[model samples]
Target: MSDAGDKVARIRELNDNFRKTFAGGMMMMTASVAALPEMVRSAAWLKVSEFDAWDTGNDPHHEHDFINFELCNRNFFWKCDYYAPDMNSGSEDPSDPEKTVRVGLLMLAEDY
Candidate 1:
């Protein structure tokens, strides 16, 4: 990370790319989320990809790293965490994409 502003911007951009494109990272689903019917899971995933309701309440850090929403009357959440390239520890600098690996989870809010 560099200056606070630049660091936040970089982190936010990286996180948005992972969330929107599911590229540059991996996303895992909780067992309950994985067990959902295909169509429902698809819809829920679509919601996750489309989520952009950010503000002080849900995204206080402004990193675009996590959100919760309702799908089929069930609450669900998606979140991202930054790790080292080897996945053995937290990244030294989350804003440095080259030194970081992004991992995310999509699961029921209840499982959060």
Candidate 2:
């Protein structure tokens, strides 16, 4: 094969590896949430992000942006929203003023 063909093959291999790793992480996250619904909910209230597979990367400037996860299970999907409590004018009670919240949402894919 040519050099370009070899490079393409390597890239495809890397992409496959990344996909598998990410999928495994998502499965683990789903299991964890299923096992500890209350804990997850409490953490959400506290704005404690970074669940097993998901991280919001909580940047203040991109609070409205979302890190999306499209799981293999077509029924479900996940997303982590970087939220700035202080910046939001709609809310009377915000969780944290200085730090952004990594709000994780797991919902039906159809609903999303």
Candidate 3:
């Protein structure tokens, strides 16, 4: 296969893995929260525009080095932390760079 084809394949694989992780994360998050119905509704209504990427310049807290996305609905809000596998370290058994693990937490506005 061509180099471009290999790159495309890698991207597709990453996207597929992300989708699966995101869906499961959302499910577990809503289930764990106090307001299950409201959480589900808010999650269902989530929009891409509402997501705040943790590493982006918009995030003011540098101390928390995790990559996360925030979702909100009315007064309720939550953050989903995505732990992407590191690929740059020079080691024989490096983490799987393509794998992404996520944790979602419900929070109040003033929790930060």
Candidate 4:
């Protein structure tokens, strides 16, 4: 293969790896939420903005802009947010979120 072909192949491989890793993390987040619904239940009193404001990033500008996928119980607060060069808009939508849900459901189905 030519140098450009090799580079393209490597980029494709890296992108695949990133997707798989992110899928796994999202599955874990969903499982934790479904397994402990009481803990991760949608807040009623607080406004959506308050929940969105929990994003604690090193970058001051990103704090308000960030959203967290949180799994909090009495003792633990597990959170995972997608990080990419671009905005995290892809994960914010539900249509594609089903892909993550399918991954979690498949694993959950397998375990039982």
Candidate 5:
């Protein structure tokens, strides 16, 4: 392959690796906290005030750094806005007794 072609291939590989590493870490963290139901439940209400796990802007992304997106229920991973209604918001009211909360994987982007 030409130099340009090789570079493109490497970039693609890096992107794939970035996505996988972020997803895996999120899953593991979720699993580890599985034993604590209350903690998991609390995670729902807790907004990610500060998180920079992935450096999406950087070219040479490492295993510990990449780009990611987080959703309230993983049902809306594509949605970037946090103000959007979550899946639970549709089924039951947060103030009601039938509340069902789920932890979402919010992607940590860099600050401008």
Candidate 6:
């Protein structure tokens, strides 16, 4: 693959790792998600960890940064937003883990 393709692949792999392990990045949830029962919320988290439904329709950029799913008949989405290492602004190079800090958000679809 070309250099650019390799970079994007690395970015996707790092993003997926952050989603599954909540490591190397921060995680935030909407108020509605925070209000869910502990058991239900735990289940939802498991779903997030196990998510692997990416495709052209939902992941056109192929970054693996956003995901939408259903739980208990309710719509939900998880998103990863890239920021600078300082956490003050967007990253200049999202493909570089050292230059970026990822923030994952979990929220109701309506909240998106």
Candidate 5 has its poorest 10 consecutive residues by lDDT at 75-84
Instruction: Report, for every candidate in turn, its global Cα lDDT versus the true structure.
Output: 0.91, 0.37, 0.41, 0.32, 0.32, 0.90
Better of 1 and 3 by TM-score: 1
TM-score of every model?
0.95, 0.29, 0.32, 0.23, 0.24, 0.95
What is candidate 2's lDDT per residue for 31-71, written digit by digit as tens?
Answer: 44455457543443233223233344632322322333333
lDDT of 4 by residue, 1-112 (tens): 9765564454333323333343333333335334544424443112222343333362242212223332232322322243332334434322232322222111122233
Cα RMSD, model 3: 8.6
**How does candidate 3 score on lDDT?**
0.41
Candidate 3: clashing pairs of residues: none
lDDT of 5 by residue, 1-112 (tens): 9766664464444334333443211222334333345553345324232233445453352322223334443321111111113442332322221342222343222221
Worst 10 residues of 6 by lDDT: 39-48
Poorly placed runs, candidate 2 (over 4 Å):
1-74, 87-97
Q: For model 2, name the residue pairs that clash.
A: none
TM-score of 4: 0.23
Candidate 5 ranges with C-alpha deviation above 4 Å: 23-112
lDDT (C-alpha) at residue 43 in model 1: 92
- Clash pairs, candidate 6, are none
TM-score of model 6 vs. true structure: 0.95
